[model samples]
Target: MAFLFPLSTFLLPAGGEYGDVRASFDEAKLNAYLAKSVPAVKAPVTIKQFKSNPTYFLTDARTVSIQTAHQVEREYTMLAAIHNYNSRPTTAPEARVPVPQVFVLCEDKEVIGTPFYIMEFLEGRIFTDMSMPGVPLEVRRECWLSAVRALGALSSLDPKDVGLEILIKSLSKVSLAQAAVKDIDTGEPVGEITGWRELIGWYESNLPDERKTGVRIVHGDYKLDNLIFHPTENRVIGILDWELCTLGSPLADLGNLTQPWVFDLADVGTLMVGFKNNPGAEPISLEDLEREYCRVTRQPYPIVEIGFARSWMLFRLSVIMQGIAARRARGQASSEQAHLYASFFNVLGRLARGVLEDEGYLPKSRAKL
Candidate 1:
């Protein structure tokens, strides 16, 4: 017997509709998209029950909440669209996915308040951390390889052919810089910090000085949790999350994926160890993972070349955390680990300064600061 439920209340957002910053999954539209696009899904079934399942697969924001059903469906459709845009042949990897006759939904705005698309749903298990106990070593390695290769394939795509010019054009330099800073969660402007280097220096130094393309499709948040794997098949069923999809340096995407692996080593084993099916079954070393990713992607080993990606990733994280810290400081949100957040701001400031100083982006007069 199959059972489904309304995961959560779909509340009309209270704040300004930021640029996909606080965007969320729209369940009604997701269902409609699937019903219209997929040939097999003829009727929309009523959500029988609604409950939340803790997703060991993602961070707090992406977890299944009141609207999990919608999120699942939305993610499925988005992944499908990306796959189609990539010119991924039906004969391509993980081709068993159902191909819907229709791809677009007409009542997208009415149901989800957005123009939404659809893709066939995939049934698979996800390992947020490659190092899990129940998973075999070989399977874990394959998962890592598949993820890196998928990212490489995505990076190698042609934006014009895939109809991604508009998405890429929508991004602004300020927004990108702000995003880099804001990810640290601090309220301070990146340039104002003392003694610390700016994050931009590191990015500029690490990435190719020349922009390869005006805009390349970027999966803003590329990480293990966002990847879906066909547990038994030893393959990635789909790449998930489109909320942050845009046109930017594909290197940014690569940087994001490998960031956690590089810095934050202290939390790597503890925070990620339990995410996979079995905790501590297969411990993946960062060195091995980095080497494999380089080989599969055919990019120079990032660990050897740029190293800015990791710095960029950390800088972004620090910025995000600082923003959170700032919010907490203002009494906007409660924080048990107030000290941790506070420390994040200081760390971000220092890191940013370090990066800028290293790249000569910081003015000579303020070298000490």
Candidate 2:
């Protein structure tokens, strides 16, 4: 449906790395003022998820894992991502999503120090694992279905109608400056010695025709863990993390949503969970997920093209992790385990190649490194 990213809930993050960067803001003025501007704000604001009222920094060290920056463009896109989705008419009762209230976007860095916005803090569940530990298996299944159907609802809307047409020009671009990637199995170059541009070409050449699905809102990082589900219900209430929002093929979102199915969750670790061998439950498949999406959108699944999207999504994920590795090397990693990503990217690459072969995008013989 749409390239939705992970499900996440925001809590107030303690002012640390971002504190010094935004020292210019007089909290006495900006703080205590939110209560007056946003009725949703109460005197005592607390942090549950800690993205709660994140203070972003302009420095590279503060580059949030999800494209955090002080640029107005980033804020505009983030606002567009949230506003467009919230503004869309609820075609289905299930499509009604409770999102964090974004009250303002002050571009002038002079206002709250490092260009900040005041938004409501939401309370919900952020399932880091697909297994949805401790939750009933059926509820887990329904939550996944609800996300699918929601994405289907997103796909049904026109970017133009939602006022997101401007995002098409600002689509995220991947740099091909990195060294050539070697095949995980054969230990041979996967593309030309020259650059990744050629490698991208090799896979895309065999992908199904790209025109079928057409353009739609691509969430860029759409996934279950990225969402914020209801506290005790199977439905999605608030959708957060709009840093990666853009306009692209609906398959981009679809491919991302189902990417885990193509790989072994064992390879990635418990941080990620897939339907098959999902920890404590019987193995499941995307048949029902696809069916639900199709039913909501009133369209058949693009089985062939989805392979291309899946491969691309995996590749994109590997690259993101690679970036984390780079950050770790520079001693700017946000997490203590950031260094571990170096080995993970290769597994993702191998998985991508597997999708290409299974989807018939490439001959099995040729796809093997």
Instruction: Judging by lDDT against the true structure, name the best candidate.
Output: 2
lDDT of 2: 0.55
Off by over 4 Å in 2: 1-25, 32-98, 166-175, 178-198, 203-211, 274-284, 365-369
- Cα TM-score per model: 0.60, 0.74
* CA deviation > 4 Å runs, candidate 1: 1-40, 48-81, 86-109, 112-119, 166-197, 201-207, 210-215, 264-291, 297-305, 330-345, 348-369
Q: Whose TM-score is greatest here? A: 2
Candidate 2 clash total?
Answer: 20
lDDT for 22 in candidate 2 is 23
RMSD of each: 9.6, 7.5
**In order, what lDDT does every prediction score?**
0.47, 0.55
Weakest 10 consecutive residues of candidate 1 by summed lDDT: 9-18
